[model samples]
Target: MPNPCFSPALAIPAMMAALLCISTGARAELGGTMSSEANSIAAAPQTLLNGALRLRTVTDAGNTTINEYATNTGQIIAYTWQGPTMPDLRALLGRYAGSYLTGAAALAPDGNLHASRVARPDVIVESGGPMRGYAGRAWLPAALPPGVTASDFH
Candidate 1:
């Protein structure tokens, strides 16, 4: 007879709970490693590192494109996202997510969410168009790779 305290039903739920924790905990951070980056997003991205910098690009099922750039040292320094809907900014920005929130909130005090841009010394963000046509890019000025320009993000 199986132990009453360890029923098959209980075991299945326990296994699922463990998996949930593992999956969420694996989310990538701006200054984290490549392995973490691969697991952070829903789909695997094509990655290339040219000794000086690493670039990873992913196009989701909706055809939304997200590009992540990292340094040879493995720290994610910049990200560019353009798609039907804005990719989750918090997941990409890490510690700098709060800065974007604060700056965006200050835009359009009259309650217009269609503002063209939100610019700050640390974070520069711009988005436009409707939900199906949304597009934007956010980056940390201090984090950009040397000799790499903002326009290079496209």
Candidate 2:
């Protein structure tokens, strides 16, 4: 913005304030509450499953929303409220639901969802890859408890 009428310094600040206002406005729409409190409590369902496969922020910074939820059934679900019915991901991840999982996940350099196993970080790949990584959300090998048929859910 090198206009004779506009100052670059002023432009930058104005842009920043506008961004802040928009960011805060989005939060206000979410009831003006930071996820810090809700996230931990909300993540409990995953913890109780395997304790090992738990929700993790994609990275420590630059990410404001929760990004991933690893389940007891060796599946990693991404969390992004971008597309239609992304809110359904929560119900799909319900305690009784160990099947469907689709949130927002970026593809890696390999064009695959970044998935990780328990006790592993940044090492996300299955020897055979995603089970049925298509449709509304992807489904992994749902490790149903003994005597429980996988067909029961469908």
Best TM-score goes to which candidate?
1
Candidate 2 Cα RMSD after full superposition onto the native fold (Å): 18.1
- The alpha-carbon RMSD values of the candidates against the true structure, listed in the order shown, are 16.1, 18.1
Worst 10 residues of 1 by lDDT: 1-10
Compute each candidate's TM-score over C-alphas: 0.64, 0.20
lDDT of 1 by residue, 2-38 (tens): 1112111212222223323332223455655544344
Q: Model 2, residue 37: displacement in angstroms?
A: 24
For residue 94, model 2's alpha carbon misses the true position, in angstroms, by 22
Clashing pairs in 2: 115-124
> What are the per-residue Cα lDDT tens digits for candidate 2 across 78-102?
2222121112322323331211111
The global C-alpha lDDT for each of the candidates, from Candidate 1 onward, is 0.55, 0.26
**Which portions of model 1 miss their true places by more than 4 Å?**
1-27, 36-50, 60-63, 109-115
